[model samples]
Target: MSQEPGWLRPHGEPWKRVSERLVYDNPWITVTEHQAVAPTGKSAIYGVVSFKNLAMAVLPLFDDGSTVLVGQHRFAHRDYSWEIPEGGGPRDVDPLESAKRELREEAGLEAAQWLPVMKVQLSNAITDEIAIGYIATGLSPVPTDPDETEELALVRVPFREALEAALAGQLPDVMTVAMLLRAYHMARERALPDALSRAMLG
Candidate 1:
């Protein structure tokens, strides 16, 4: 790696964890309270929300610049959100498998090709949750088997429309916004298959 003039550097001492105790535990998440020292040497009380599974998402793309989106009422935000297929998989499981399952269950679609698009730390300040996203092509319809907890609404729309919605903040989920922007970048840079890129750009 070259040390370019415009590059940034990281130089900092790590935070010191003095003590931690579990305050709440659930199958999906655990909350732990910690007595910690910040990197600046300040004492602080921190509560961390840890996830038990890896987050996964997929953008199911068709050859003609069309995509499948799923809508559901989010409990945390208490609002309806339109997003790509997303779910959680066991940390030990492959993320691609989870992406495929989410596409099937949320959008009733399956893909013959899958490419990793992005990896994100959802909230660096609060949670230890990471999300992985993928772009899936060569799509086919299937029966949806959504999780019992989900009451999903499905829609198919042009890729450009979805991206525009994300850009306008209509789709505010961090994972969805990242995936859409990444997909746009890939299409412009020809990172995807040629025909797919052309179709997506159109």
Candidate 2:
């Protein structure tokens, strides 16, 4: 008999699940408690938060090298926040559509171009929340139709300044921070258009 290739084998021993219970359920999230056996043969209890939708964000870039940010009071954090246009995309929907809707609803902007920047996990240790980020250009005005629950303020700032704010911890939203940093990296590495990159760098 031929031996199995190392690459064909499992990367690690799988956890043996003993039991799982639904701890909580909401429109957007579900929490579950699980009892499992570890790879080391030790029993463990774990809690996992699962999201019903994919988190999506967009960095709207203008021809002038400026970007739009949305400011609002976050109830969960009980603080004011400035972030890129972000919202939840239903699992069955395309994330780009969600990003476009959020940008229009939050900032009243529409884009002729959309470049997906990154996909990431928000909190792997505690939550199974995934986020997709995009850079939107070729912009135009649109009518804002924000969620009634949102009381938002729009701010237009130079891309570099926004990035600086994000780096300085002014923008605490994970999606915003990561996307801003990614944009900066892309500009510096010439991953973006020369004109656009030059405008943003300035």
Candidate 3:
């Protein structure tokens, strides 16, 4: 009989294991394993899942002060999602480039100016997906080139209303909300009193 693949072999419970990762080796992130004791004092192996991700989302702010959003389906959540132009790609791609691509693909809009607003982690307590948020300003409409599988609608909402939706828990995708919040604050940072100078500077 042939031996099973090293990664297919069991390391712990049926669902958890120190399996070979399915992503590239990026220096910013990697996995590690260690032994641990449960609260019940039972011994088990812990597999730390890690990888640096390039998650870019854009808030396309028109000169009119209305922001553009893209509505797409999220099969993982079994719901249609309305979000900023966003994507998850290999860490190899320039994050700003990813933002530009996503903006054009999803909303058919491009900005004359791009601001890198936030570099945040999805959930540092668990995964290692780093999200890069951007504020896209001075917009111009263009022909959309969405992925073949995409069926999306471009929406324009006022900046204040977008902020309200994000804060009122109406935006279901936490990641989108988080990034939009950052992008919004960053877009308005110049007008504010420069309270978060470091964040605004970056």
| Candidate with best TM-score | 1
lDDT of each: 0.90, 0.93, 0.70
Give the winner by lDDT: 2
Question: lDDT tens digits, residues 1-202, model 2?
Answer: 9998879977767878899999999999999999999888899998999999999899999888899999999998899999999998899998989989888998999999999999999989889899999999999998999999999999999999999998899899999999999999999999999999999999
Full ranking by TM-score: 1, 2, 3
* 1-202: candidate 1 lDDT, tens digit per residue: 9676754655688888999999999899999999999989999999999999999989888999888888999998889999889999999999888888888888898899999978889897989999999999989989999999999998889899999999899999888888888999999999998998888888
For candidate 3, report its TM-score: 0.70
lDDT, candidate 3, at 99? 83
Query: How displaced is residue 121 in candidate 3, in Å?
Result: 0.7
Instruction: Tell me the spans in candidate 2 whose CA falls farther than 4 Å from its real position.
Output: 1-12
Per-model TM against the reference? 0.95, 0.92, 0.70
- Which scores higher on lDDT, 2 or 3? 2
Cα RMSDs, all models:
1.7, 4.4, 11.7
What's each prediction's clash count?
A: 0, 0, 0
Candidate 1 lDDT (Cα, 0 to 1): 0.90
Worst 10 residues of 1 by lDDT: 2-11
Residue 49 of model 1: what lDDT? 97
Task: Please say which candidate is ahead in TM-score: 1 or 2.
Answer: 1
